[model samples]
Target chain A: MSNAIDRGKIEALKSMLLSLHKGESIEELKRKFKDVLETISPVEIPLVEQELVREGVSISEILRLCDLHVELIRDTLRSSLLMDVPKGHPVSLISRENEHIAKLAEALNVYAGALSKASSGEAESHLKAISNILAELRKSRLHYRKIQMLIFPYLERRGITAIPRVLWGREDQVIVKLRELSTLVEKELTHPKEYPNIAEKAMEVSREISDLIFREERILLPAVWILLSEGEWVAIHEAAKDIGYLIPIDVEWASRAKLLLPYEVNGVVTREQVESLPQEFKFAALATLAPDTYEVRSEEDLEFETGFLSKDEVEAIFRHLPIEVTYADVNDRVTFFSQSIFRKGFARTKTIIGRRLGYCHPPRLEHFVKSNVDDLKAGKS
Target chain B: MSNAIDRGKIEALKSMLLSLHKGESIEELKRKFKDVLETISPVEIPLVEQELVREGVSISEILRLCDLHVELIRDTLRSSLLMDVPKGHPVSLISRENEHIAKLAEALNVYAGALSKASSGEAESHLKAISNILAELRKSRLHYRKIQMLIFPYLERRGITAIPRVLWGREDQVIVKLRELSTLVEKELTHPKEYPNIAEKAMEVSREISDLIFREERILLPAVWILLSEGEWVAIHEAAKDIGYLIPIDVEWASRAKLLLPYEVNGVVTREQVESLPQEFKFAALATLAPDTYEVRSEEDLEFETGFLSKDEVEAIFRHLPIEVTYADVNDRVTFFSQSIFRKGFARTKTIIGRRLGYCHPPRLEHFVKSNVDDLKAGKS
Candidate 1:
């Protein structure tokens, strides 16, 4: 009923979280703030959380507590947030797709339940279920592509980078793990021992992924709805068209459609438009959610301390290097790989760019690589 | 001293190493193979280690046993690997630099001995000692750069890539840790709590540096001597000339240098020849240790199903991409980074190649990246 955010309620939540981090017993934490803990609505969670961060609570600390916060609020979380979905809106479609993805993950996990042991029915059917799950999991890549291209850039432009930094990294980890599990199933099909591990990994991944979808819908979508402008959502929907989503939308945001129509004039609908347009148009109004877009211009040649080169020349120089180069960022996300002319040192594709470092080698060698990296970091080597 | 390649002797060593890995009690191992283990030479350790790898032992498996093998052979490992160093030999110069590095390390560790407690010295002197060590530790970069450029390419060409893979990755790691320690000391000067940790890290790093030098002189040099050819060593020395070693060589490999000179008709010494030659040439014959070098032919441009791309075009394509990329191979040694025209993402140089992935971030974030990578690989995320 109240429009104003309660600063005292937020402080209670913050102190509870800080106390929890200080190794305070959860029982004590609950006892200390029993009234506030029970009364805090899920709708206020992100608002208070964001405000805490703005007031200098560490993003990493918030990340450490995020899921725990969600868990604590799970019961009261459902009834609080009011959905004001506009039919055919980009946010509306994304919310629907989140539900679909959760269903898909649940369906796979149910099928995977048949695969706890190699002795469960026909090995052939069990493996078939796994193969089918792998196929559907592969479609999650489309979900990821949408998030990376559409949502992340929008979040970043809104200075909501912490979520993308922490959350999208988790997404990349999920994809890499999915790929790993798929490879295990595909390559080691004859080994029955691989089945149990596959089922376990698949179930875990599916559950984690479904949880991610919930976070997006509950925390992220509402924030985007409030923060973004109309034209930005239009750009996002347009980009999503270029890189499709997990599920197709059956509706479009109608109030923005008039603004979207390039040839429409004076708020008047022509007779031809009435006949040619889709038979039924949903009446949905939006205050428009627009995200900022960056413009890239290649104005001139790149000059280095040692020499100068055109963009073409710089590209040529990298390509001409005797060895192939692939770069994984500090976050282990593959950002680029040079296509070597001398010899294609390591084969890489565009899709691999946003993935983590785990897939670049045979799975067995991954540990050794990882250990060496750790030792290098810890000065143990 | 048998000059013969005794098959039984090699097998015995391999089996001992394998048994050690199999978690055979070290006491039992000592009882079973006490005679052989104590007598194994430093040169024989790598020889047996390399042979074990060739005989179906995984290189990674050997890596696990590497330290244990070093420990087992520590007693008489010193006496058996005889150095036939000529005064001006490249090996001799490297050996001298190893001594310098070891002493440098020992000196720092000794200085670091003061700071175990906060009361070890004036905070000013403690900081100054750390600063000096950091400056010297930074020079390990030169030791690394030379090895990457001069030795690794030659090793890979010789099909001796396993050594480069393991050893060079370790070197890259050392350089990265060195860089990390330097940053911590530089940034955390005002924090007294940071100094004891710095002291501990510096001591660890210095001791490791000294141990690395010992490995180089005792194991690697001897291995290089046996495996490489005269021209390969000359090429290594030549490449070393380009890259520079940790410390400059006051001597030259002259028999090779005379051969390095273009055809001179007269065998007799002339006054003009003596005057014209570079004054710094000191006679050092390397017992003529050389490595096998591969002749690389530029057969043609790389062809893929997508289309053929010239080295230039491939470079252009990578440079044209929006993201900067660097490739660290399965060993975590950085092989390459693409220079994107849009943003110089990670400031990488030629020196970074043959270095580990640890160099990509701060010491704190290195663990974060490594853990993420391992989690991705393990399918844990």
Candidate 2:
């Protein structure tokens, strides 16, 4: 049966990772499992790794073998289709952040190499460069946060849990390592004794970050691009705006598509959907997916602490109100304002949405509004 | 030199219109002014009419001459390009509503004809049918309301004031006639002597509505479509939603273009812009438009009664607020909910921005929410 072959392949992948963790060379392990590596699907690597974690193989140990695992299956992932995500779309923004993260990772490694070989007289500059790169590299957490928060839920709803778990584990490891490396580099600024050790740690974190980027661009984005509908993407894109982006985003990629939430999907990937998926995800897409059974309102409906309401009803209420209401968020951004049916007290249009509160006022009143906002923030009002 | 020629043309047009007002036959007048009618621009009709009013020619006289005027220049206006407006766009929506309005107008005429031929027994039924059609016909006011509120302001802001004024005059006449016909029909049920008079008024109103529709589709839409940017269309589309429509609108036509207000335009239509306009509008587009010199805040800034604030500052203030806020309008529609930076009160997303307040709550609380809304409307709370 195909199940037998799948089990055999996962077992082989697990052993190869275990051999790499036990100090076997990646090249040697890759050669020994060349046939298995070539046949391994992108989704299978994560499943096997999750299995190893359950069997008491430590996360750090698996993290150590990640580069080896990535190396083994690099060719297979590389051959999967690369989607041309449109500019300003959530996927495109994530991919752009990864490119920036990759450059910083490479910079950290380069400066680490320089720190290792630099004469004692020139060692301070290299340490400073390494520290700067590490701090910049730490900002990749925002990039990772979007993936975990905005994208993972859609995949988890489809029962594709292993990929998120494995990717998250690697991302967490890099985050922790980057923090420690920053602390170590600062301490070394005075002691100057752990130069070689700090250099080695920097290289390790750099490699881990690089490996995660490869997995995201090759495995995760391509799979989601195929699986998520325009509605889901619209939901993701809208929510992601609140979280902020790592880059200056382009003009919004407006979608007239209806909003769709993860809970709305039936958790079944049809044969046609599977056929459209990249080679890296075809098996996972075709696999039996556990239905997301959590009961929820329609995506157009909002569940407040009191009850639920659809979007149409909400908009109607605002327009029907007698008094005009304007709301500025904590950061002084003009996020929303109400338009009364009979009269608008002042000239306010949808264009004013997302503009700065200070700028909404004339120059004379700008200071007055800012002070009022400050007073409110200080709990004086 | 061109001003003299323009003056001579206006004088000739005035004389021809005065002759028509003096009970001249339309066919005879068309022969007399064939050259002037052929060369008359779309904007000139409104301008010359405005002039005639300034020179003491009554609006009723001009209204009487309208059919003659339309007949004489119909061939030239017919040669103007008809744009294939995209579905759901404001222009397309207006045109679609006009299509429905035209059908009602035709139906009114048909019923009026039928009423003229009906016996005393059949006359009451014809009167009932006329009343039903008139009730439906009166709903076209909502269509006219959108044009007056949403579309006309953009033109007026450009200092092209004559067209909106002339069109509104025609629209007002049709509305008043429709009302009077409804009243006369109701009274005719008791006193059948005025049946012929009621039928004649119905035909007249129908013809007027048809003429207004022709003017809207041929003159106004084509001109504004050329003048307004995607941003302006976005603003118009957003504002028009509150006014409702004559017909069920198609899906929203979204544009990612930045919002541009009429005041933001320099009030000058360049040579290139004039060239791109429809043949009927070329003279208007090229004319020396009076500058709209009223100063205002940027389109992205909202001018409140107390002060003004740009959209960004307003949004920031809302986001930084500690407590989550949800707002429902007078109609119990949930128009807005504040998104706190920290903990959210519930699963309120942007998707629920326009939802019904009752639907946003649990089923058990739906009744409670409804009563609270009713009590608020009653001003008891």
Candidate 3:
């Protein structure tokens, strides 16, 4: 199915594009291309691009054709989108933040338009509103940061690296443009001649933010909603709490689902899981079958001198201990350490486990610890 | 302060103990020993016992004296108890379960009395009621098991071993008695002539369970409430969910406190912590000061070839991965491995880190893995 492309479906989609190129309005094309849209899935877009390139079509022309295709399928994307989620859920909270930012972006555009049209008296008030909106818009970085940190990693783990990287790149661009536009806005306040430039820049930043919001709501989040499990959502909710929300999250979303990491996902989307997915994802997911091989799920007890404990219990015991305890072998190479959750004494990574004990401590305390270790080794302590 | 006890206070308590032994009722002694009770703390019990021993008092006599002292302090212990907690909090839930079990024990006693008094016709209904009560009482083992598993480990880590162990002993007795009495009750249903013996055993079990309830409410819970932090309670609540509650817990108790284990507690109880403690714990807490010692609270990032990540971040990255990744040194000794949350394929503990790679797997897979490693080492397909 991955290798075989339906030539008939491709020809049908290409003819739809040809019909639109011959001066058919987008609305008119949408009505005609509805059947063709169902036939051509999103995964087939790359292959279609390849086939179109192999013919006499230019790359820029293909991109224009793809953009027209997206416009035609916009309703389909919205219809298959995440319409409702439990309040306080990660997806719901993120979508709420997106809604808030969209309003701010709309307000920014309105203020920018007002500033350009205002009389001298109204210009002050309009500029003030623009600055305030920019300040609020700047806080959306927290929203974008959460997307990059909490959500993107799961996609990366599932081998969907390109999408997250591309989205992150666009998110970073929005952040950078906002910062530069803020500086320009500040300059505009002093020299009033720079008003035109600031207004243009603000509108551009506003447009970029709106575009990202559309991409998130239509593509990224809906796709993630299909791909990530409840356990992954729980983790995202926990990590997102530290980053915080644009709007207050008063309700507590509770689930009995255990914490499942990306590595815990066996790569294969089972038939039941695929069946539950929306139409847009089902075709792509069914076509791309990943191997469900070699998972490690061991909860067997390990007997110690004191008692029997599972590895998780042992790990938890070590983490909860108050003091730092690192062990060095007789050869003086680091072997193990207790990973106290509140590690206040010294900074050490698991990478330090195989390193020499001398390199484990801060340089100032290195000699003192080395001497103490030596004294103990020599039975002099 | 731990080593030294006020001799005047000890002598006062000794005389009070003597008064109880010399034909005074516990109620009369309690009235007389009000001032002496203020002078002597619970920690001073051992010191007063030592003084009584030096005065040539018999151990049995001193034990009776101590029992009288406990009766005198009953009001004081009750006064310093955990009066209220959020509905779904672990301590609150456990206390609620205790209340339910106490009512069941009372019903068991009532049913036993009725069975002994009723004619043969009424005995059937009375016995049925007793059997039902016994079934409910048996479920209390879930409650006891939680205390032993979830709560005791924290107390053990805090170096307060004896209390958890002693309470656990009494809890085990209740469980064992309930099992034995359940079997005997079945026998009584058939034989009917065993009513006298069954009634006597039922009363004994009822008394024992009631006594445990008194101890848990007065001593165990009050001590635990004072000693445990919010984080510990959160962990207890999470673990208790798996064991389940005897009563329904409708409300979701929420806390923002991070998971702080017993080992994370620096031994010293700060002045602020002491100030917040109930009157019963303050004196003992203030007198016994332990070393604050070394704490590890590092959040510094470790630079890797790809990017900089905190140790926790690296640990989390490993945990959340969808695949089990184990790295061995050139010597074929395991150095590091991803600790996947769901270890489905193999049961390897952290102890396997320094073990030879061949021994890390099952015997059958050991040779297969070894051959593959050798082939890779020699650059063979």
Candidate 4:
């Protein structure tokens, strides 16, 4: 791989990548890659790849030069894998795990801030706070470890591995830093004289954790652009459906990638290989695989059919809605409410569930409550 | 008078005044006016001498058994006169000639969470929009007439008579109401068409001006309150100072009588006598009678005093401050900036004033600018 050859290969690859548009089929991507590779020496491939991975390419530059459809890129890559990808997909599982880790990082930051502000004499109080925050952070770490140990092996087997390895390393650094800060905080709790100094160290640890978050957002996941295929992402998404993200909401993908295989490979595929394909692929294959094995629809079709949510999944989905929800019965009694940590005031189901609407009012203003409710129900005041 | 007679006279005066607080001066006031009265009846004395001549008071049936302090009662009467009588006093002058006649009622309800959402419209566009707002409402007629004919007379007598009564009347109302609706806007020219329909009735003559403002704030002000006070509020403060209020800031009363005398006069002192007394004799003779003789305090005793600013008043005062000022300047290049109506993005005397240092960046590299500023400034970076 001479420098001249590598530079030419990089330029051709960049041009091809820039020309790629949204919704291009697998054949289009393969053709573009093949054309660029044919003109380049094989030895230059590694250098070209590394150059593409380097940072400092401004987002504006990408927006201006990239031929890939912005919306498609965002839809496939930025969307949460767990929510958008099909069941049993590898990408979905990774996304859900990443989300859990992010939540843990946030919780740790809160705890670290609180502990730093705590007095040395209040050791027990600081410990309790740190324990709670660390507990949440630990949950994220456990989720991350699951993906690194259990999930990455399958991706590595398929040659879609480098991105996860990088992210996992970054995650380990965060865990080590957090552990060190936690120990320092614990020691300071027992020694009143070491109050302010321990706080400064805790803040430094919190900052490092924040930097880890930045790495995940800017470097780690973005590197996945060169890895996960659409079908794998769909499969991982489906497999991770049961796993929960820290702050759940509908996740959006960043970009979509299509995979292509040669005709010779298709002829060698077995029944098991076909069965293991993603749901979308399975449906598409069944539609055309054998005309006698599937029914055909003749009427003009306007509606699209999709997967159904299980009862528990439906409940979980509502629980993870972005906006807070509280409902009162027709009788004006509190029936249910979502318990969000960021809630402005205390709300306990036990205290409010069957309580009369008037009970919520301050003692001096019970009449005002009854009157407002009556006014709402009645046609006239 | 004998001690017993003096005590009896005090008690009698208290009874006459419906047993209100009988301060130390009650007997003296009673004795001074005792011989001049046409009637000696306890009820008649209060109605004639105290109630009619000074601030009026009516005895409630519920107060029959209460003991009264004469000095407290007199002080109350004095303060009431101070408030209502001072048509030309600083407080009265500023309050009475309030140019934004329509917003006056709402301004008074500041304590009740009203009139706090004041804001100006956009730079070039908002000025025209606000002008259209004022012209469309045609509220200036009634608002201006009321202040000029009804209110300015009283304010003018107090040496506060400088602000162009008509012009300021128009500007003040526009500035205040514009400020109230400024933040609630989705666009510079078009305000929300709902209550406080600032966009629709730019200058409609309606008594419900305050009501409209209150309604507009219910939606617009809260969102503005978040950033407006902390960052952008400085700009509004600077602009407000330059425009100046409709009434003068420092007022000199026409006469002490305006502050200490009630509207209705008692027949105790003949009108001829009051008229015949020299102006100096009226004030000076109350305690000492020599012309041009006055008690003077030494310059050493005249030290500067400081006081706290109420949250709303602070906003008002800051808006009116002479020099432009910005916050966190050494860190960011103009994160917040103040552009006065007179100045075009530059402060005349205080350039780079009230601008968050960060805002000075060229359009293309804002992020780079921010990162460099943040890093170079250490934690502030």
**TM-score, every prediction:** 0.31, 0.34, 0.32, 0.21
What is model 1's DockQ versus the real complex? 0.01
DockQ value of candidate 2: 0.02
How displaced is residue B21 in candidate 3, in Å? Answer: 99
Q: What is the TM-score of chain A alone in each candidate?
A: 0.49, 0.59, 0.55, 0.35
Docking class of 1: incorrect
Q: Tens-digit lDDT track for model 4 on A35-134? A: 5545543223323433543422322233222222212223333424224444323444444445454344433433344444554554457566665566
User: Best by lDDT, which number?
Assistant: 2
| Cα lDDT of model 2 by residue, B62-155, tens digit | 5554564445334444325444567899888887787677667655665675666566787788788789889999988778877765666566
Candidate 2: tens digits of C-alpha lDDT, residues A273-333: 7787766577666564574454444575555433344545444544554556677555565
Residue B152 local lDDT, model 4: 31
Candidate 3: misplaced stretches above 4 Å? A1-81, A119-122, A271-381, B1-381
Q: Write the per-residue lDDT of candidate 1 for residues A1-381, one digit (tens) a residue.
A: 243668898788778778878988766776787788777754455446545555666544554444434445434432133256576677777665665665555545544545554464445575676676677767776666666546555444432344555666667777777788778777656665557777688777876776677667556665556544566567566656655666777876544531221111122223443343221110101211322232211245332321223445445555646666665544554444556666733233332333335434433466887887677457674
Q: Which candidate leads the pack in TM-score?
A: 2
Provide the TM-score of the second chain in candidate 2.
Answer: 0.58
Q: List, residue by residue over B1-381, the lDDT tens digit for candidate 4.
A: 111223344444445454224433445554554553213322222222222112222223212212122122223212231233334333333233322432332222221111112334223343343444444334333333333322332222221223323334443565455445444433444543342344333323222443333222222122122211121222222222233345444543333222110101111322343343334223322332221111111232211111111223222322433333333333232212222233323222111222233333222445787787677558452
Which tens-of-lDDT digit does each residue in B1-381 have in candidate 3? 274677787677667767767878877876887787776654345445555555655444555554543443344444355766667888878877876776677557656655555677867776777888899999998888777666765554444445655677777777888898888878768877767566668767877887787777676777677777888787677668867889999788988887654435544555776676655456656555453222222345443321233445445544644555565545665445555665666433332333346544333454699899999689685
Of candidate 1 chain B, the 10-residue stretch with the lowest lDDT total is B258-267
DockQ of 4: 0.01
Please report how far candidate 2 places residue B364 from its true position, in Å: 39
